[model samples]
Structure formats: C-alpha cells, structure tokens
Target chain A: MTNAPEITGETDIAPPVSSTGIVAWMRERLFSSPLNIIMTVLCGLLVIATLPPFIEWALIKAVWISPTADACRAARGGACWAFIAEKHRLILFGLYPYDEQWRPLLAALVNIALIVASCMRRFWNIRLLYIWGIGLVLISWLMWGGVLGLSYVENTKWGGLPLTLILATFGVGFAFPFGIVLALGRRSNMPAIKTLCIMYIELIRGVPLISLLFMSSVMLPLFFPEGFSIDKLLRAQIAIIMFAAAYIAEVVRGGLQAIPKGQYEAADALGLSYWKKTGLIILPQALKIVIPPMVSLFIAMFKDTSLVVIIGIFDLMNATKASLTDTAWKGFAVESYIFVSIIYFVFCFSMSKYSQQLEARLATGHKR
Target chain B: MKKVKATAFAVLAMVAAGSVGMAASPALAGATFDAVKARGILQCGVNTALGGFSAPDSKGEWQGIDVDVCRAVAAAMFGDASKVRFSPLTSQARLTALQSGEIDMLSRNTTLTLQRDAAIGLNPTGVTFYDGQGFLVPKKLNVKSAKELGGATVCVQSGSTTELNLADYFRAQKMEFKPVVFEKLEELVAAFFAGRCDVYTSDASQLASGRALQAPNPDDYVILPEIISKEPLGPFVRHGDDQWHDVVRWSLFAMIEAEEYGITSKNVDEMLKSNDPNVKRILGVTPGMGKALGLDDKWAYNIIKLVGNYGESYERNVGSGSKLNLPRGYNAQWSKGGLLYAWPIR
Candidate 1:
C-alpha cells in the first residue's frame, strides 16, 4: 500500500464547518430551498396568529390567585387563574374524606412509581409486572382500608384526581394482556374461538362509551341475579376495560401481522411448542413494534376518561365543573376550564412526544 | 320559575318588519328583533322537557308556566300569542345561546342571580317562580332527612346552582359526600334511578317532575323537605339592550299587574273601555306612557288580551289543571301574601 501514501492537503482535516450560527441554520433549513422558505413563512404566520394571544391569556396576564370575581374582570385582558387556585383541591379530591386524602395521594405516588420503573430499560422484565399488582393492591388497601387499623372508605366516595388516576392505570394495565389474548384468538385457526373474539371486539367498538356506561349502570343490574349487584365504580371500570380492550386488540393484531412468516418457520425449525414459540419469538418483537401506537392509545384513553364525568363518577373534569358551581366563584368558568385544559394538554402532549421518541428508537432497529 | 317561551317564530306575525325596518344581522342586538319580524316569527327559547314547567301535552301543544311567559311576550310584541317558534335548550346551552343572540329571549326555568346580571352580561327581568334546592332519595335508603345521609353519593346536573347547594348543605352538616354529575338533567335523573347515585338533588319542583316521569313506581322515591338554597327562577334578556330588557321585564310585570287589577284575558276588552283610571291607563286609553318606552300604548292591553293574567297562566301550566299539579306556594298574588308584586304600569 506504499505506507498509506503521503499526508493530504491542509483542508483535509476540517472540510468546511459551514458557519454554525442562527443565521446559517435559518438560511439552510428555512431559506435554502423555495419550498422550505414558503413553509417557514407559513409556519411563522400561523405561530404569530395563534401563539402570542394564547401565551398572553394562559401565562403572561393570567391572575394566579384572586379573592373575588371582581379580581378577574374578564374585560381586563387576562385569565383568572385564581379561580383554579381556590377550587383546585375540590376539583381534584371531590368527596374523598378530607383527612384520609393522604391515602389517595400515596396511592397515586405508588402508581406513578410503578409506571416509571416499568419504563426504565434496565427493569423491563416479568418482575416489573409484579410492581403493578403490588401497587394496585397497596393502593386499594390504602384507599379502602379495613386493614392495618385504618378506617375503611367505600369506592363510591372516590372522586377527583385519585379516581381519574385509578381508572386510567387499572384500565390500561388489565386491558393490555386481555387485548393480546383477544388478538391471538382472533387470528387463530380455531374458527369458533376466532369468531367469538371477533364478535366481541367488533360489538364493543361499534357503540359509544356513553351507551356502554349506561348499559353497565342500568342494564347490568337487570342481567344479574336479584341481590347480586355490582358497584357503580366496578361497573364503569369493567365497561372501560372492555371498551379499551377492543381498540387494543386491533392495534395488537396489526403488530402480529407485521411479523414476517420466516420467523414462524424458524421457530418451528427449533421444534418449539406453539405457545412457547409465539411467546418467546413473536411477542417480544411485535410488542416492541407496536409501542408507539400503544402510547397513543393511552393518551386517547386519558381524554376519554373525561366522559366518566357524565355518568356521575367525579373524575378530574367533573370535579373542576363541580367546583365552579360555587356561588363564590359563579362567573369564573373561563378560568376553571383553562386550568383543566392545561392539565389535560400537558399529560396528552407529553405522552404523544414520548410516543414519537419511542417510534424513532424503534425505527432505528428496522432497516426495511 | 317556569318561564316557557310560547312564541318562537311569532314575533314576525304582527310586527311590520320590512327590509328597511332594522338591520337583519345577528351581531347587533336590536337587529335580531328586526330579523324575527322580517322572518314573521318570534324565535323563543324554552325547555325541552320538564313536566308542568315547559313540556308538550298529549296533542303536542306546548304548555306550562314558562310557555305562557313566552306567549305573553309574543302577544305583547305581535298581538298574536300563537305566532311563536319554540327552541328547546338544555341548562348548559341556555346562557351561551342567549349570549350569542341565537334567541330573542330565554324563557326557560332560569334562576335569577347577580352573577348572571353583572358577570354573564344578561338581565333578569323578574322572578317567575321562587324555588329551592332539595334532595330526593329512594325509599329503600330509608333516609328521612338529608342530614342523615352523610356519605351518600348525589346525582346532580353539572352546571347549575343546585350542585353548589348540595356541597354546602352536606359540608355544613359536617358530612362528606360524593357527587355524580351529568351535563343533562334527563341523564342525571336516569342515572339516579338506575342506582348509580344514592340520592338525586336539584330544584324541589324538578325533583318532583323527575319522580313523576319514572315508571315501575314513582312512590319508590321521596323528596326530602329541607330547602337548601334559594332559586329565584326568572326570564333573562341580553345586556346592553335596555329597551329590550324593559319590554321583557314589563311584559312579565304586566301579567302580575293585570292580575292585581282584576283584568282577565276573558274580559280584557271590557276592561279597556272601563272608567277606572288604572285600568284605562294600563289599557292605553292614556297613550303618553307608551311614548316614553318607545312602544305603542296598547302594549299591556295586547299582553293581557293575548295571554292570560299571572294566576291563569300558572293554573293552566303547573297548577291544578296541569299534569305537574304543583301548588302555587310562593307564586301566588301579593294580596295573598305571595311574592308576585308588580310596579304601576303608569
């Protein structure tokens, strides 16, 4: 190789750093091509028209606290955040016993902790599943008492932020596995089992949540034997789980379909049982591929949780509305609405961003 | 107070709302009146369903206390009580619709509040019915007083004063309770009966009305006697339009004034030719007062002749003659120690 040839020119080491500055970035991405320039201008105008007033209303001029409605003065050109500050507790806690609220708070923390633990790549194992089970049991035990010398509280009295968290956590936690089983069953060669699963998924997906909740609340009682009644929260929870399962099944089915036929043949070549092959070979890759869609589903479920307010379970939105009905804060609806909207937007936007990140990570592994 | 709007499209019938009469745009307040007159109908807002308050009868004709208020206003404006179009609104949508100028006036069973007047930019003309919030629990619960049920779950409409009252009542009793809320009264009531909630709380009259609609047996539930909060139901007009407010306010006052003056719809014409100065002044025999309000002197006469007096409207809608069969407890005439007092027409 002639000793790697002689050294190159002076410019070889640093070809050209192309001016690293805002102006350079602006020129390259925003003004380099005609299409890019047009898109930038369009986006700029959209931001100007939308973002400034929103920022002004939501942050810059918003009153963080006010003793009376006069302090808001809607004409004064600012949001009345004080209304939310005053009633936020009521909106978040609903009818939970005041002193016992610590239980729900602790429960919420545990649930959040479990979710965080599961998200860490280092802890992504079957043991992580126990976190959820333990967390749910601890939460219910903490909230419902009747053990450990704590006073027992009924589920019906559960409302506010705690109720909302419980519904969403339990809803997705139980729904995921159920959805996977349903998807597998639907795709199975067994015609009877497939038909039953297909019918179930379709029927649940066909109706609105309101009707399902109504059926659970009203028609469910009629179906059960006399004196064997389900609690309102349980009825609503079951309806939510069933509703979520149908959607999740469809998503999971897509993931399963994306697995190549060669993988199945390779698993068969290993002489593995059907369950063992599918569980060890197919599920791991399929679930990884479907992470983005699953996250999006979670965000959607969060929004749908608001509908529970309509049926009398005082979720976050319901509690906000309930707090506004106070004669002391009668005209502070705009403030209250904005606060809850912020809460919803923050959670949903973060989830969507996380989903995007997961999609990018997953994309790196799949060259095709 | 039950304030059903009778004339939804009827404002156009008697008013000569020509192209040049006024602006036809909805953005302007008075312009809507011109539009209604041009369209030859009054756009009236009423309740969709509330027994005896503003519900349709067997033949589908709207009847109730609120309906007669609309009819009275329509009769005053158009000289024809039946020349109205009824638009029903849920409680949540009522204020927004009126604020947006979707309807001329809201004659639903809307409560009068200072917040509605100063904050929401709507004017309360007068109280039509004096109601109070109360609780209704199923008989199986065996709860006689609301105070006894400390931890009970209550079903209440999402956006009403009743919700606040429920919280305050329970809190004052040092009892903690959960509330299941719905945006619609019908849905809330249905949920209550379906056993989703332990108690149903609302305006006492509404509790009675909801109970009546329940099948199987209405007697399975009982409305508690504790009156929690004062709910002075009334008609509302949009703010910034003093003339329209005056018209709506006086139209309601005219009914009470007519009842006080013993002027019945059956003999309003005979009273028009009477020698009594009060009757003649109210009947427009003395026309100068109408000039001040920018209306014809015959406005009160048109109101009485078209829609009956206060007592007559109540009896026809919510009292003994109607399905609601609600007694005229606090809605009776001022002479009978009730609150239906009216200022002088002249």
Candidate 2:
C-alpha cells in the first residue's frame, strides 16, 4: 500500500483508505449507509435460507432416472429429474411420429440457425433475402416431405418447438405486409377503402383472440360448402394472422402519422409519383422509427403463441403440458414448466438484444 | 310489378336458407359413417389429461379408457386399431369440437346431463363409466362418512359440476358448511394439502387419482363413502346422425357383450370357434350383425382382438390392474350387481 503524503498548508492530501481492497469496496458500497447495511443483511439471510435447499433439490439430491414414482419416493422428495429424463422426448415433440422426429429436430435447428444468422448486422443485405428464400424452401421440404423420396408428413403432424416457431414467424411475416396495406388504406382519403379498413380493424380488435381462434376452428368449417375441407392447423394460422395484423396495423399507422410534413413536401417538390413519394421518402423514414415498437410487438406475439394451447395445437407450451400427463410424473409440473420457461426466456432475451442493436444501427436522423 | 319483385326476393332468400339447412344436416341421411370411412380414420376428441380416462404415457402414446374406446371404433371400421387420430381437448372445447365436425366423436369424460343432450345437440351413445361426485378428507380429520362434514370447510373447483353438486348436497342434507373455491384443480389440491380446507370434493375417480398421484402420503387421504351425484360419463356424437350413433353405441355394446361371453382380446380367436350361439354371434362366426351398422362381418371380432372387452378395459385402465385402482362398484356388469347392461348384440 502507498503511504499518505505529509499534510501541508500548501497542498491538500487525500487520506488513505484503511483497507484498499474488495473489503474496502464492500464496506463503502454495501454497508456505508444504515439502509444499505440493513438491506444487505436481509438479502444475505434470504440467500442463506433459500439457496442451499434449492441447490440441493435441483442438483445434489435430484433423481436422474427412475422406472416409477415409487423409486422417486424411496429417495427423499427432491426434484424428480427422473420424470424429465424419461419424458423429455414427449415434451419436445408431442405426438409427432417417433421415427420421424429427426425431421422436426432438423427443422427446428435450421430455423434457429436462420434466426441467429439474420440477427447479425453483417448479414443484413440482399444476400440475406436469398438465404431466407432458399432456407425456407429447404425447411418446408424437410418438414412436409412428399418429394425427394421422403415419406409424406402432414402439417397436422407438426408439433412442439417447430410448431411454435412456424406459428410465430409465419404469423408475424404475414402480419407485417398486411398491416402496412391496412395502415396505408386507412390513411388514404378514398372513402370506401378507408371505411373497409376501419371496419376490419375494429371487428378483429373487438373480440378476444380465443373467440377468433374458436370461430376459425369451429364456425369456419361449418360455413364451408359441403365436400370442401380445410386443415385445422391452417385455420388456426389464419386466425393468428388476422388477430396480429389488426394490432400491427395500428402500430404502423402511428409510425406513418409521425412522419413530418416536410418529407411529403420535399417529395412533392421533386415531382415524384405518389408511389415513389410514399415508398422512398415516407415509408423508409417511418419504418425505421417504428422498428422498436414492431419488434416489441413481435415479442408479444411470440408469447401469445402459447394461447394456441387452448385450441390444441401442441405448440411448445402444450407439448410440455402434455408431457406431464404421465401418471409416474403427475405431481412434477413445476419442473416441467420451469424447463419450458427457460426455452422461452432464451428466445425472447435474444430478440430484445437484437432490437436494441437494430435501434442503434438505425439511429440516422437523431444525431443531436 | 314492385310486389312481384319483392315476392321473388323473398323466394330466393328462402331457397338459400333451405339449402344451408340441408347442407348442415347432411348427416340426417347417414352421411357421417361414409364420411368417416372416406377419411380413412376416426377423429376422436378426448380430455387433455385424466389418469384413468385419457392421458399421454411417457412414449407420447395416449392410453386410457377414453382412448381405447375410440380405437375400438377404429378397429370395428377398418379392422385396424391404429387408424384413429386423437384430438386432445379442454372441457370448454370438447362439445364445440364435436359440434363443428372437428371430431367425429368425443370419448372424453363428459357427464351425460339432460341439458347437454338437448341444448348442445349431443346424442349420448352409451354410459362408459358410472362416476359419482364424492369427498376426500385427511386421515387426521377422522371423518368416515360425508355426513360428519356438515360444518367442514371444503375446497372445490369453482364453476364446475363438482362445485354445484357440493352446494346442492349440503343444502339437501340441511347442513352448514364453508366452501373454499379455486378456479383450477391444481390450486384446489394445493389448498387442501396446505391445510387451507378440511375436505376436498370432486368426482370420486378424480379424487382417488389425485390422492394416489399427488398427495404427500397416499394413505393419508380417504374418499368418503357417500356419493351425491350420478356423473354417467359417456361418449357422444352430434344429434343428427342416428346411424353413426348406433355404430358408436353398438361398438361399446359389443365389448360389454364380449365380456358377458368371457371373450377377451387374448381368447377372442378361440371364441370365434365356440359352439355357443351368443359367443359365435359376437365373434361374427354367425353373420348378419354388421350390415345394420354398415360395417364388415368381423366388426365385433376386430374390436375384441384389437382393443378388448369392457371388463378387460376396466381392469387395465382404472380398476385393479391400473394405478387409480378404482373399484368396479356401480360400473360392474349387470349380472354382477352393477348397472352396466348392454342390449343383446344379436
């Protein structure tokens, strides 16, 4: 430790800390004030009370595999990981044919790789478009394989993580373009188009998504002409698209309305056509500004995919729920739910991080 | 001229409405049986998860009484038990699923109430299980009968048949009791186990399963002897199709009659050679039974071979052969002092 210089009237000397290590830092930050000390001690007490038992239950005392609940009970009541170890495949794939699970596993991994690759700033190019275009073709081919000598797997057979991804990604992808169209039409001065847009938005937004899904699953089939049938999965996908598009239209409309009048005036002065003015001048600026809210909406919709459990889609949430139906593992819902929650958190957390990065990259006009 | 045009408009509207009505009730002409045959699979709706009724095993294969019922129908139709798709449904979605034609039939544990049969346009094919609402109490409570729980605080799921039955039973017996209501089965079970209530009330099958599967000590909880309501859980189809209804109803009846003739999945082939007329008729050794249901001559034999008799299913699923271990009390065959009586298969 360095010694303090001798005190003199000519210059001021800062006093040396008694302990100049982590101990000193802890003293200043953790116990420097009365409230701080109290909070720290209380938190320490809480950790002492909860942490060891939790660690013991989750790790140390947990059962790895057991044939029955009797075995789980013969050991003391800790986390019955034996249940998870036994049922993890069922939780991950639902009722997908066991032999063909490699297809869905490949489909899910391809989706994740595409998602991760797209999040990279360097991959933000026209080449990215080609990658997605080709990747989707491959994924579709792999998932619904009738060609290439692979056995035909219907869309109804799709379940678990792949189903969740298919629903969210397809729902948001369709909603984005549909929303833009509705927003533009709503802003259009043409009376009939604006009225139609308003009616659609209000109608979809008026009812809960559950009722919308129910109508699609039930009422739409009855309404269909005799001998005509639609797939149940396709019906649910359409309902999600309709519900999300209405909400997204409102968000895009806010972005469009926020575009300054100066941009419109500038485009008009340049003798630009109406399409050019809106596409180049207005939408480019408006879409950039709305990217944050749009990403948030996408995240919200990702969570809303869980609601399809009500309609029996066997998405990740429902598959996890289905896994716990085993009589051997009947009481261990907490562990199963916690496992699925972690999967959700990982996807959502990465999306949030990507949104922040995109915001920073797109901060062009807000230099000051 | 204006009056004539108005009359023409009314006639056109009536024609359109009549066409839609005809389309809706196409099943009235026995279309569902053909539709199911053309589809090459029977669409069966079942509970999301119930221990003795319908639940997915570790292999993601649904195996229980409700699941087997549908498979039996599949066997009767195609002579193969695997030609069925299970649509797992919540309680709220079950009837809507059947009504909307999403499923051809529902073998879920739905109580066959008069209102359900009439208002919801459901035709109860046959009662599969004679379940009843009952109470469960901790061993420490020392309550041997539901009668002693007059002033007890009971935990029950709100807005369910169990909740309504509990209130009705207390009122009918002229007893005073406090009720703790939870909207979820997990919450009610938790509350009861956490000492928040003195008694837990639900269907006896559910209570027995809950205690066996979830209680800290299975021996600590005992279901009360008094059963208050008749659940009469059964499979049902939409109301317009009596032909399809008979197909489903007689499929179950064949199983019951198979048990009466002592023809199990194991011995069904042997029974096909029996000289006894009843067993011969059930095994389709004697012909003419399948034409009425528009099925093959070996329909009963297929169900018996692929699935099992009612007694076998009972023993394998919810009775002594399974974890729930529910007794064959009211569900026993007619000759064995139980209410399960099927019409003669012949």
**Top candidate, metric DockQ:** 2
Residue B83, model 1, lDDT: 71
Instruction: Return the number of clashes found in candidate 2.
Output: 0
TM-score of each: 0.52, 0.91
Model 1 C-alpha lDDT per residue in residues A38-137, reported as the tens digit of each score: 9999999999999999889878988877666556654356777787777766666665666777887787788778767866767777888777678878
lDDT of 2 by residue, A214-245 (tens): 66665565444445568878888888999899
lDDT of each: 0.74, 0.83
Q: RMSD for all candidates, in order, please.
A: 24.0, 5.4
Chain B alone, TM-score of each model? 0.78, 0.89
Q: How well is each residue in B174-269 modelled by candidate 2, as lDDT tens digits?
A: 999999989867767867878899999999888887888778888998898999999999999987777789999999999888998899999988
Per residue, candidate 1 scores C-alpha lDDT tens digits across B50-123 of 55666543223556778888887777777788877665554544654465455678888888876677655577
